[model samples]
Target: MATMEYNVFVGSETGLLKAANCAEEKWNNLNTLEDVKKDNEICCMCWGSSQQEKVYFAQRNQLIKVYNILSGEICEEIELNAGEGKFKNIAVFDQQILTALDSGIVNLWNNKGESELEIKTGDKLSCMRQNFFKRNLVATGGKENPLKLWDINKPTEPIFTSKNVPHDWLNLRVPIHVMSIGFIPKSEKIVTGTGYHQVRVYDPSTYQRRPVLNVTFDEYPITALTVCPNGNQVIVGNTQGNMTKIDLRKGNVACRYKGFAGGIKDLQCHPTLPYVASCSLDRFLRIHHMDLKHIMHKFYMKSRLNCLLLSKKWPTIDDEGGSPTDVSKEKIDDMSDALWDKLPVLGSKEQLPSGKMQKTKKRKLATKELPKQKMKKSVC
Candidate 1:
């Protein structure tokens, strides 16, 4: 039997896209695609619906491009709805493609690139998500906007709306700024990451609009969130470079991993592994094991990273039961210890030798006078 393989596709700040066949020990970066230029920013990306071989990428200019990962070919290109606005998320299923715009409008497009339906969410729309189990159900939220669920079939009204929590101790109404949203798997609830540094879960099956679960994290805004495979926890990243695992069942911080130097832009978990990957404004991509607080690999990507897509498919190992891909040898050869030693260390202090004092030397001009220049001959 041929083993299933999945490749990871990444989008950068300059719209540079890359694919990699990942393994437990090493991975290989595939050739770059000329379709995504180095001048535009990537808004979001996701695997295509109906097939895992294709992926769709949205840009800052409202242009969407589809690519075949295995063949590295351009499958199709479609323009978003008229009136330029920042691109949001794309949810692909069967013959339909749903795109969310920053203007709080969700557009449904057919395979032939025709707009079929449009849903008006609200203003300041920061995030939107299509239900994982129920394709027709979608969630939307943003600044000062409560969480809402809508049915794609009935574009007129939302099925449910979340009620804001009671005022704070000072009686000031709390604000809403949901930066990211996703549907909970194997359940009827949804999770959201907010600008208020909160991770909230909402269940619409009940009549109450208040969140079923609410937990506060760092003081900085939570920019991105992804559900763990177990469906009982979520990995959340904040603008203050804090990435933590929050247990949904217990409503407490599970583990706090380090490695983010700049603010995080996106966070994604491995398809069926215990690894987590992140891209950020620091122009670096970092991967770490969920159980380990240290980094596994860190790469300087030359451009700020906005979003990343990890394919569900992975390579089939050999009959010997070991993966063929190994980067250890190449990684060791690629390392330059001498080059690094010659470079200046940032944020580090110069240390003097132990139990030794060095005297400073000043340069002095020569005490002996030099010979003067001879006069030139004037006449013959």
Candidate 2:
């Protein structure tokens, strides 16, 4: 098969990796159905190199599969034995592969899949993220695990460790459950989302151990989050399927996107564009414009999605070979019309000969009826 370029790559719970071209509305399953197994389900994914020509994904089976974008084939597979639980996240730096497991074991593997260095971050590691600007720096956190920043070169103790917030006004201890982490660009600040519905920003440069900025979203636990390209805001998704963009400066909600039916699993902001892509347990991959606050493209994969990766080479709307705004608006209108047609219309109420109300079919009108007391008063 010829090499194919895709804008989006999605990993699913069924152990299937799919590539999509948003402009073309095309999808291709990179893995065969025969290889699909419970243990092969992908849990985390990261670009293998800055070139974006390859991808590294970790499975529940403790295997890291590297897929080549140029040839569209599995280039290599690295098995990980240093971790105990499922992989929470994976990162690539230099030529080494970094894998973090729920047991809090972080291992850096060489080309031969030999462990070069290992660091025990903490227990219940929910997330591990590398600083894109400083590839050698990484952050890790999880349930009851405060955020810690490590320098992979010197894999001894963390350079900076975050302290839990002080007790609440009622004198009750606060909980710590860092479910996701993101490093803001052009700065050393790190943002984290917790299971306690909190979004916090930590400044490593400051002597203060606690968060410099802390804000809460909805009532449910935050499951996924990503810093936007602007670095002034971060987008977060909760367990209840709510995705909101929050201004980091003031710690206020900027906007919220709709159309999610299940909890978000992963979120990725485009490196250069005003777009953010998200995958959810609802089995849908959606791309939304940050400013528009509306979905630009939505694709339904047969299996539940776990992680999403957006290529830096993703095509712009104009690259789709048409007027960008017109084409997108037309597509959106067609989809909306189709969905509206499928919905059943409510019938209007009408009086029958016996003074009872009857409904007329095929009409789009209010079907609500007056209560008995109101009806009697109106009749009298």
Candidate 3:
């Protein structure tokens, strides 16, 4: 088995420090917010690689700013239109910045403060997600009763759109409120968490609703959805302070745990490990391993953690010699054939819930009443 390493990097009242291995609780006062120059209420934090340094981005109500982790200095800052609306969502793409407005639009801007594009969306443009495999494509959905998919190159029109696409739980009778969206990494399917504690996966090729994965939460309004680095597990965090993990291939619950005292708002998986990080209204940033035990490793923040991003672990080529040329191609082919024979087929309807709402055999419509089309007066 490959040995996995875990590390906790936190910013606290003292300064940025790598917590003593497995002794996170002992290393209190790890750092302070003075490193970022903010009054607090930080909604998002992301680490990205620039040149040889790892840079971090932290967004508050009025500013989208960047910091060089190596130098511990704020490198760039741009004023965002987040006065009345909090900078609830922030995504860093190349040098371009994408932010979602509570006012129901997604704005893209360049590094030099030039507005790139704006996507007008539903009533509450609650969340926005980028494709893990393709950065240019983004999906946004919220109380609008519809999910919008837009390509960055063409912001005026969405390539795909769907309403009442089973984005919510079955018991919820309200219009689909797509609170969160997550991509399945390399796959075309993406899952969105909705208001009723339900998550739905759909094929991007066609906007039709497909497999409805009912998630059990301690409460309603699933706020975040994230796929583990392995791509085999899906996890969702809800308002009731529960983070449930499900096996995507098996369509079965893998594990469930109470992530925080208050509701969970956002979660991010380690870029290269099986670790998961989440933030909650309970004013805590917690990290856990995606396993049966679901060990709670560290609690880092004091205010509600609105968003998080782990540093990407780039893979390095082994200096040791690889497979020898003497290894026959026929032997490799034989091993591949054996593995294929044991692959599991994902073709079963999930077991119906017992106390929960009956599995609706027929798809639910947005509204029972269809609008009447007025009959034009006969010209004759």
Candidate 4:
């Protein structure tokens, strides 16, 4: 049996791991329904290896499963012993696995699955993301919890801690509910999406710990965000299913993407391609081109999706698994070819054996003349 090569991997709230082939517009459930349980619900997912040959997903029951992409099997399962609440995110750095829970506990496990270090950042943690350029660094923030950058090596104190913005014109303190966090590539700047419908950019290199730029989207809270490869813009989605691209330089909305029905749970951009993948509570996984106005592909998943990982190895003709072909075109072409082969070819001047070409005479009709209207014409 040949396994399908998937470019998009989605985790559902009902404990189903789905793999989607964007080129073919088809999806498959990696795990069966029998393996699904309430406690096994997937909360977050990340690539287990640099080559993306494996997947690492954390569940609600504090269990982490390593899925092998080539074999299509769960090769390893590691249960997290430290941490309260559900796992929020998982990251891998230098062969070490890091897991963060909503209780604000980040545990570092070695290759043997032994807990080596644990850092208690804070409570009600909503998001934790690893820096792409610096693997040892991570950023965390949540409801009432300010953004903090931590170095796993030190683990003693946060290297950078963000301060809340100043009070509004009404003298009321600004609320802090960071739903998603993303690090801008090639720079120390970090972008965060808040539950207060704000997209903020924090610069650690600055003297002040407050966000250097702030922009608001829709009325609802921003649920997910992903930084573009250009490092100058960020795409954010809210609970109202509205996604917008914000320019960090001018702090303005650049573009808005449509075709979502419910709250967006997660957003991930392709590492090199000009495409982005998103999963939502609407039970659909959609891929949109960064330069186009319409969506590229949309798949209907059976269960509500939580998080999705976009593989860097996009499907091509030379990939291990076969490439997706247009079945409808192949079938239609084959039928037309067969029909044309069986049909008889006729000569231009050929005639039937019973008779040659015959000509028929034209018929003439008598003309009728009416009384002339000279008097009426003169009056006109």
Misplaced by over 4 Å in model 2 are 319-380
The deviation in Å at residue 64 for candidate 2 is 1.1
lDDT of 2 by residue, 74-178 (tens): 999987677469989899988899889899999998988899899999888999999999999999999989999999989899999999889999999998899
3 against 4, candidate with superior lDDT: 4
lDDT of 2 at 105: 93
lDDT of 2 at 10: 96
Which pairs clash in model 1? Answer: 5-313, 5-314, 6-313, 6-314
Task: Let me know the TM-score candidate 2 reaches against the reference structure.
Answer: 0.85
Judged by lDDT against the true structure, how good is candidate 4? Answer: 0.87
lDDT of 4 by residue, 48-126 (tens): 7778999999889888889999998989988768645888899998888998989999989986778999998898999
lDDT head-to-head 1 vs 2, winner: 2
lDDT of each residue in 62-125, candidate 3, tens digit only = 5666655455445767775532564556676776788777677778777776677777765666
Question: Model 2 clash pairs?
Answer: none
- Tens-place lDDT per residue, model 1, 16-132, is 665544554433333255535644567888878645777888877767778776676667878665354677788875567888887888888886667888888998788888887
lDDT of each: 0.76, 0.89, 0.62, 0.87
| Candidate number achieving the greatest TM-score relative to the actual structure | 2
Going through the candidates in order, what is the number of backbone clashes in each? 4, 0, 6, 0
Mind sharing the TM-score for model 3? 0.68
* Candidate 1 Cα lDDT to native: 0.76
lDDT of candidate model 3 versus the reference: 0.62
